[model samples]
Target: MAGSRTKGSDTLRAAQMYYLQDLTMDAIARELRVSRSTVSRLLSTARETGLVQVQIRSPMDSAPELERAIRAKYRVDVHVVPVADSVNEVEVMERVCLQAARTIGPLVDSNAIIGVAWGATISAVSRHLTRKITHGSVIVQLNGAGNTQTTGITYASEIMRRFGNAYGARVEQFPVPAFFDQAETKKLMWRERSVLRILGLQERMTMAIFGVGSVDADVPSHVYSGGYLDEVDIDSLAASAVVGDVATVFFRADGSDAGIVLNERSSGPELALLRGVRRRICVVSGESKLNGLRGALAAGLATDLILDEATARSLVESDGAAEDAVGGFLPLDTASGR
Candidate 1:
């Protein structure tokens, strides 16, 4: 026990020198009369033992012009991840998701209810979440994952589980189809006691996290490829001039869901419900999703956005004549108001 205490003391000292004093590993090794490799191990042990915590602030402030432009134009807070022009879309997505995970970790707290919409971007973000322990917090699925070919429980549950595990929160799964065959079926299911429980939880959500789904993404969105939609559904969306979706709810390029037809059967929360959540974090990446992102922003679905620099540049550079003509987001009844 004496030896163990001494070793822990040495590890903490090494971490302080290396992180705070900015001393090199060799310097730390010499001071402690240990080999350089041992010093490295000590530093690693410090981090593993939680004796040292590292935080990387986003570089969004570095590009003040870009960040300001996005905030001014979109009316949402933006975290613009810096990605090189050389990086592929996949790499860009990885970096942006990492930033998003870090950003979300501190915002959650005990007794907070978080709503999560499952998808490619969100799944990736889930993989990168920084563990944050909380009590009485609930991570609820914002949409169902069932489809004709598969239940989609394994895929969607895994994502929710990751978030729940990371936050030390309870998981609430929405067990239903992503899109029902008939809108009437959804209407009927919404009235069920089991479904109403989840809906009631949703109305109490304090924060919501989601990714915009786009058919044209460089990396395909899960909703478009996950067997959730059939040929008829695809044809309907295309005919309706739908650009993309927030969760499973489809919307047109002008951010209007008025005649989208498909949204009537979607299990995802309505845009109004989502907007009512105190904090809405929308994570989107890749240039292919620009149209979808534009529509989502136009709808005022997001209170904050996490996106890559290139995509942000493209978005702000555009004239946005169509979205402007559509004017601002239409007012809708809130969960309680409705």
Candidate 2:
């Protein structure tokens, strides 16, 4: 019994130095005063005998209950960012973005194709991405940015550029209009060979990152306030009972996004197409996005969500969430002008 216990202690020390301290096999052998072959056997035996343990724990600050509740309520993965009660709303948003980047960075791989949609929340998250060297990965724009008032390229391009730079991925831009005046014009343009190439890349996307565009979010969705929509557009959306949009494709409170007249002219991919993506990460900030987030979830748009704790609690604790099994439709006040 004494000899067996001494062997176990030796195994642990060898693992600590060889694995934990980044020591080479030869170096470990020298420190342990054993042959290199012996060190190899010990390391192998340590793992095989269950003497070396490895665990991946949740973040210390994670809200496991909120994560559990949101997962139970929505049936999707939830990452709740830790935002102190003292931090301002903007800082809260930035922290959410940081966590989102951290979550997404590991999922990227060499030669993977990712689709990205530009918006305030997504833009914020993109800028803080974890630097990586994922060669052959392509980041394709999911929607056009150009509007009548301004060329949308500068803003959206900057956002895409930041993502590309961080991941060392190639970028494919969509330089078409955000919304065409006539639906026929969009249909005609989409068939062009040059446009088809970008569309093809969009089709092959393995992962997509976007924000649920809310008309009432604390950080007002850029597409709504970015001169992409006119008074008539706003009026039409409201009259049609539209709640919010994802990638400029508007959906209702009940998650119906198809056959809407405004959708025909929008350049964003339809919700049906987005549903097919393997990993769809939706990063949201303020509680004012409750309706929009609910709408996206109703359509089965997001596979992962990262947001602040207050918003997560509000979502999981809202009224009628259990009955419908759709979303948390609580009323929240969101300030603007960031």
Candidate 3:
């Protein structure tokens, strides 16, 4: 009887190795010092005993739950993009762009001022926009398109042209750096009547769209890898405990503005200004951007969020972790303007 029991245990072990460990029957047989037939029999027994119960977790399965959690937490419209586990960075960006375009296309109308931020993700969205042009609609660049290394006007122009062509609306470009070298320059530019006119249109924008920037995002974030920030600037952002950004403005993990020097130079609207917009849509992706996404929410920058299922899950799971790191819930004052 003892010998019989030993043989049974060997059979179970062989089955576990073959079925659960995903080894070939022959490999299991060799490892267990048994025949292939024995390995096969063990695998059958393992299945019978429910030891090898296989489940294929669908990436789509988690999207509903994620959307629920995100909406409940942030009180905003959330669209969770279903992505397979093996999706690459470019594919992820494409999905995000597609979804954003679908969502935004119907929302636009004549006499609407639509503000756009320049970045790879937003550029992708612009490419996918198929809406027909209507009268009195205008697409405006939100910030200066220039960076430290080069002028990003080409990128900005491409987005503007696409939107203008699709909507048959006028395109208004900011025609400046992503950030001014000095606050005084920004102040002086704001005083220029022509600049002020464009800025006024931006301020009155009916709808605004942008992408979040993660400090360690897998998909290259425009602000981090876009040659907008130098080594010293990156180092300073890290030292300031920055997690993520919306429109090139860094925010802390708790959704508070970092008040970094770079912000002084940034041309994007302040968080408060973003919140004041009738509709502020933010598109982001990747598990790496989880923290940044959270910060954007905590800061109340996103009235609507478009993200992938994986990222949405990570954000929900990170609540406790963020509270410990940041020491409080982010204030809900939409007018605070971090």
**Which candidate achieves the best lDDT against the true structure?**
1
lDDT of 3 by residue, 232-304 (tens): 8889888889887787777887777746777888888877787889988998878888878877887888788
lDDT of 1 by residue, 206-307 (tens): 999999999889999999988888899899999998889998998776677786789999999998888788999999999899989977877778889999
Order of models, best TM-score first: 1, 2, 3
Tens-digit lDDT track for model 2 on 120-232? 99999987775666779999999999999988999999999988998899999999988999999999999999999999998888999999998887778999889898999
How many collisions per candidate? 0, 0, 3
Ranking of all predicted structures according to lDDT, beginning with the best and ending with the worst = 1, 2, 3
Q: State model 1's lDDT.
A: 0.86
Query: Predicted candidate 3: what Cα RMSD to the true structure?
Result: 17.0
Cα lDDT, all candidates: 0.86, 0.82, 0.79
Cα lDDT for residue 235, model 2?
89
- How many clashes (backbone atoms < 3 Å, residues ≥3 apart in a chain or on different chains) does model 1 have? 0
Model 2 ranges off by over 4 Å: 1-62, 319-338
- What would the TM-scores of all predictions be? 0.80, 0.79, 0.77
